[model samples]
Target: MQVLVCGGTGCTSSASHQLREALRREIKARGLSSRVRVFKTGCFGFCKLGPLVVVYPGQILYCRVGVPDVREMVERHFAGGKVVERLLYREPATGEKKLRLHDVHFFQAQQRVALRHCGLINPEDVTEYIACGGYFALADVLLHQTPAQVIETVKKSGLRGRGGGGFPTGKKWEMAAAAPGAEKYVVCNADEGDPGAFMDRSILEGDPHSVLEAMAIAGYAIGAAEGYIYVRAEYPIAVERLERAIRQAREQGLLGRRLFNTGFDFDIDLRLGAGAFVCGEETALLRSATGQRGEPRPRPPYPAQCGLWGKPTLLNNVETYANVPAIISRGADWFASMGTENSKGTKVFSLAGKIMNTGLIEVPMGTTLRTIVFNIGGGIPHGRKFKAVQTGGPSGGCIPEAGLDTPVDYDSLRRIGSMMGSGGLIVMDESDCMVDIAKFYLQFSQDESCGQCTPCRVGVKRMTEILERITEGKGEMSDLDELADLAREVKDASLCGLGQTAPNPVLSTLQYFRDEYEAHIRDKRCPAGVCRALLDYVIDEEKCVSCGLCAKNCVARAINGEKKGRPYFIDRQKCLKCGVCAAHCPQEAIYTA
Candidate 1:
């Protein structure tokens, strides 16, 4: 019997380390350490109820576990052979206990291919990874199949790169293989700098071996002997796990020298990025790996043709490499059968924002946004209406409620002015202002721009200024037209993918929620009551109880009237429009105009 504790970053922040230590102490104290082993593994995906603890061979899942609950788990579940019913994950609506991870609604629709070994195997244990068919693909590629055959299998799988841009994976490998160089390289872009994106980090923390195995396979396919994983310095846990996995793989003869006795030599080294968002781009990543300033160069020759010290290089994100092993093991047809016609297999999304079930989920490509937001995500929180769902982090666009029924695939999402980016899906409800959302993404892109190209460096900044003016109620009608023109200019003139797709949020929001922008600029009214500068807080005389709550809570001393008698009124000049009076009012008398 084994107990798996969530070792992902999210759970670690919630004191999951203490929980793991407590479980180990409990096992030792009860003298069940021999019979039952406690281990720390990667994310279980159900982050809403983390830190998650799962017991296997029984596959019993317990959610929201803490250090204090460790003794009961050991005493009842491990030693006595019974589940702790109070600790099990309960269905919100039905109020029933969900034993297995699959029984939970959040995981029911998800088909985890990239996240195959994530919650299952202990990432630090090489034996556990090997038992689950880890290194088998690399061995098969090196011994039986030729490099061409391996590339063909990937091409047939229809597996586009999961890193922001949906480039063909096999084509990228083939380009590097065909490039005239005896010394080529494979790079894993683990520099996931997108705000609110934890997909790459989760994969590295949970299934580090999969990446190592896949990188070895990539090296064999692309005629490269050495690979580099360019990870951000911010992801310390992922970096530690990756380093450990690499060392373990080398010791087991799965990485260095003749891997798996196949005489095909391949190994990987780690390259730490200095938390630059532009380093997420292929060319910028190549520059950073070479110990230079991380910036993107113009891509006529692309990374596959000329990359990593002027040698042929193949680059793919953490999630993309995570999918490689499953494709090689199960065959292309098996993987292709899961998703839509163009897009194959499952896509992992870090589901966040105003959704009830904000966690990590891997659903098939054809799964509609409605299914993701309403079913798997448990809809929006606080009984609010769904306004839009933002995909692709800062580089992607927002899909309004009208596009909810649209199937989530590469081509489908692209058609709606959004790309299947690193798979960061942030759900937005009615309370969120669309104009503010566009401004937020624009600000992120503007800040992350490498400042190499004139259009990207200047255009993104100008667009942000325009957005800020509009949000602050200082915008004119011409600002909308100016925004469209600037977005087009930035998209056309940018050097790399970072600047090229930066305009997506502005363009898509304008296309879908133009009325909101008009309302902000023309009428100077924030319909959602989000733009504090444009809104005025006033006391509703009819509903006011003359209680001292509003007056006490007001920082500006705006409310003044007889307490517990007549209705109170707010002085417009003294009111800071902070909404503290509105929030403090028990009778809901305060209104924003």
Candidate 2:
């Protein structure tokens, strides 16, 4: 029997490493060390109930596994030949235990193309990666195909940039290849700075070799001997794994000079960024990589035309490169057959927010928001009404419940005022105030702006100020029009994608939840009761038992109920709106509106 424990950063922080230690010790104690094997793999994608443990050949996937549970799992499941029914995932709706990985609703709809080897293989072991057909595509490209032929195969596969733009990967490679330069470069953009997005980081942590091979393959296609992976320094696990993978590739003669003795020389270099959100942009990334400030530069000469010290460059994100190996091996038709007509293949998304199952998911490109949120994400938690889902992070938009059924293609999302921005799907519940949500993203955007353009530097700041005033119940109706006008100006005049897509969340929320904005502007009431300045906390007259809990809990002494068996009263002027009374009320009488 083999035991696979989740070693991804998410699970590791949650004592998955301790659990692994306990499992090994337990296996030895049970005298099953010879028979049972243990290996720590990357994310299982079901991160909500982590750290997860999958026992094979039974394939009993146990969730919320602890260090204490390891002994019983080894002794009973391994030796006693019994299943640990308690740890199995219980279906959120049906309340039924699901033992296997595919049986869980969270993973049922996922296709796993880029993430094919993520949770299965040990990232540190090159042999394990090879066993599951890792670098076979690169070998095939080196031995059996020409660079043009390789580019053609990628073109036919319809592989778009998985990094925000969704540009055709083949076309970008071709431009770099055709550019007038003997000295060209291949770049893997791993500086993932999007809030709630972890697709690239997770891929690197799980399968770094896939990226190295893909980069080498790209170098060969684009006629470049060197490649650089610009990753964030914050991702220590990903960096360590990538460094190991690169060393292993070099030691095996997969990289460096004359790979497979085909006279093809390709190697990779790691460039670390200082966690600047603007550095995710190609030009800004190149600048940061070259030891300059992370800022966007004006584009007429795109990266393919002139990049990285004025040389032609082919830049693709980690997720984009991760797909290369699969496309080469599985044939373009197989990959292109799955998704929508234009948007072919699957997209890996970080499922977050109020959803029951918050993890990573890879659905077909045209999969609906409803399918991702409800079917695969196991719906909203606590029976709360689904309000909206914010995709593409701050650069993307808020898709309301009305647009839940809309297919998530590039055109479909674009038509609905959203883009597939690095696949960050943040689910919002009824309790989340759309106005505040807009404000939050706008603030992030304004802070992240590189100040290279007036539209982004001044315009985004002005828009944010307007949003802040609205949240504080000091906004006028005309401020809405002002916001819209400023958003368009900044979007049109910005120098890079960072400034261009910054106002998306604000624009999207304004379009979908206009009433929420009006509630703040006209009524001075936060309908979602989220904006603290506009909220009013009061004790319910009918529900309050006069237990004095509200009065006792109120640090401001705003709740006044001197006598017993009388309803507590909250002084509006003195009340701090801290919700201390509501949280401490035994009768659950206090309410916010």
Q: Backbone clashes per model, in order?
A: 0, 0
**CA shift at 533, candidate 2, in angstroms?**
1.3
Tens-place lDDT per residue, model 2, 1-593, is 89999999999999998988889988998799998988989888888899998888867899999987887788789899898899999998889998788888777778999899888989998989989987899999999999999999999999999998999999998999999979999999999988899999999999999999999999999899999999999999999999999999999988899998889999999999989899999999999999989887878799999899889999999999999999999999999998999899999999999999899989888999999998999889988999999989989999999999989889899999998999999999999999999988888988888888899999999999999999999999999999999999999989899889999998898899999999999999999899999988877899888888778778898889755767889999999999888889888888887
Highest TM-score among the candidates is held by which one?
A: 2
Alpha-carbon runs more than 4 Å astray in model 2? 563-565
For all the candidates, what are their Cα RMSDs to the real structure? 1.6, 1.1
| Ten residues in sequence with the least summed lDDT for candidate 1 | 255-264
Tens-place lDDT per residue, model 1, 1-593, is 98889989999999999999999888999999888887888998888889998888877889899988988888898888888999998877668998876778888878889998888888888898999998889888888999999999999999999997788898888888999979999999999987778998999999999999899999999889999999999999999999999999888888888776766788899999999899988888999899898899877788888999998899999999999999999999998898888888889899999988888889889899999999999998778899999999888899999999989888999999998889899998888899999999989888888899998999999999999999999999999999999999999989988889999999999999999999999899988889988998888888998887999998888889999788899898888888888888999999998
Model 1, residue 448: distance off in Å is 0.8
Question: How does each model score on TM-score?
Answer: 0.97, 0.98
Question: Which residue pairs collide, candidate 2?
Answer: none
Question: In candidate 2, where is summed lDDT lowest over 10 consecutive residues?
Answer: 559-568
Error of 1 at 84 (Å): 2.5
Q: Roughly what TM-score does model 2 have, to 2 decimal places?
A: 0.98
